[model samples]
Target: MAASLAAKVHYLDITGEIDVFEHASSLDGEARQANILLCPGVGFDVIPTDCLALALKQALPDATSLCLGFESHSLKSPGTAKTTVEGIGQGTKIRREATIRTEPMGVRARRIDFGQGERLAVAFPWGDVSTAYKTTGIPSITVYVAVTSSFRLAMLAANLLAPILRLPLVRRRMLASAGTAVGPDTEARREAPTYLWGEVRNESGEVRTARIRTANGYDVTIHGALAVLRHIMEMRDFDPGFTTPALLCGASLIEELPGSGKIKIR
Candidate 1:
């Protein structure tokens, strides 16, 4: 449930193929505090790695910061990438050719008490955020997780483990992630053409995609799958066929994967 309606802006600080301006902001969190963040569609720019923190810092004023520190979080990448646990894990300082959004990364939001206050946040982000900071009043921000396999499993496990999992009494609360959904479930057929997303490191080391369904016979690649999946998922909250955040994934032209390409409709 949301209380206010304001189109927020996010600034990215990094070097990428292009500049992305499309975005969405949400006050997505539970219990104590109302957390807020700007979410972008898949195949879109997440916070740029280089200027993520500084840019975020500019977004926030002095009062809203709870706790800030350098952390390696997994939030950007979905599927198996969202299962990263928070800790002081050190990363090698290598010149990153790929952006932060390329991996399952995260940003950490410090805990702060906001009482029905409206404020913006900007900071150099560690990226992935876990739902721990709970505050009431005001639209506060905690953490937002993209819908992914690892994230989904972690969330599922945590939900079942509950307060007991948090307690030292049975401290073993780490969620076990299922490695990969390697096989296809043809029995679980879809009325429409479904999407299969993720990186494809093939003969060429660089990542490439393969989106296989297009009734109009357009190019459907990995990026295309995400675009389609995002549209369908977005439809659940807002009708892509007939609503805001319009479904532009061209679902009308997609029915099944093309015969030449391997499009898994699970």
Candidate 2:
């Protein structure tokens, strides 16, 4: 990205990694100086949720805290599975009072309804915790993923064995056990739709909730990335700095995508 900025070209990526996003954000000045955009997380990882965060913020402009949750039936690609292995011992990440904080795994869990019945969702180091803060300026942020009982048990085991799990050999073994398929098949992609939910609460106790349904993760990643690129190509003027998809194109970015459903509020 630095090279791209130095080359005076717009830099964009579909990364959902928090550390990478943070690093990109640190280059805001350089990006602006070069009149180029340093936008990342233009994928299922943050686009849907980040745009939802902005939507909730608009609905409750004074919201002080935000909670975002997602449930997806999409099968993990090899890359996604490898990412899971890499984070085997990492802690949960949240934004508190505009500051990023890391807490123990499984430290937070809640019931969230993603336009369906309630499900048990646990906090995870989702990229939105960082991007959404930038998009909405919400001080408190938490991102959760719905889990099955067996999956929850696996997380508990991973938490208790963090030290051992952190070993390179162990992570490698886990990765080896995970097959190297690229991702879901075309049929699976058609069958699997992802759901996202979010809530915002102000200091005055007012609250707003919204939900979105979109195509499978991989499909959304592909389309969302292209959509953002197209929008940038169509824009006559865009801010030249580290920015979220919503920040760059408003909350409508997600809705304007090929497979995103309407944002339902309650």
Best by TM-score: 2
Model 1 TM-score, all chains together: 0.21
Candidate 2, 146-208: lDDT as tens digits: 988777777877888999988888888899866575678999898889889999999999989
What Cα-based lDDT does every candidate model obtain?
A: 0.24, 0.88
Count of residue pairs whose backbone atoms collide, per candidate: 41, 0
Candidate 1 regions exceeding 4 Å error are 1-23, 26-39, 43-160, 166-221, 225-246, 253-266
- Residue 224 CA displacement from its true place in model 2, Å: 0.6
The alpha-carbon RMSD values of the candidates against the true structure, listed in the order shown, are 20.9, 1.2
226 Cα displacement, candidate 2 (Å): 0.6
Please identify model 2 stretches exceeding 4 Å from their true place: 179-182
TM-score of each: 0.21, 0.97
- Choose the strongest candidate by lDDT: 2
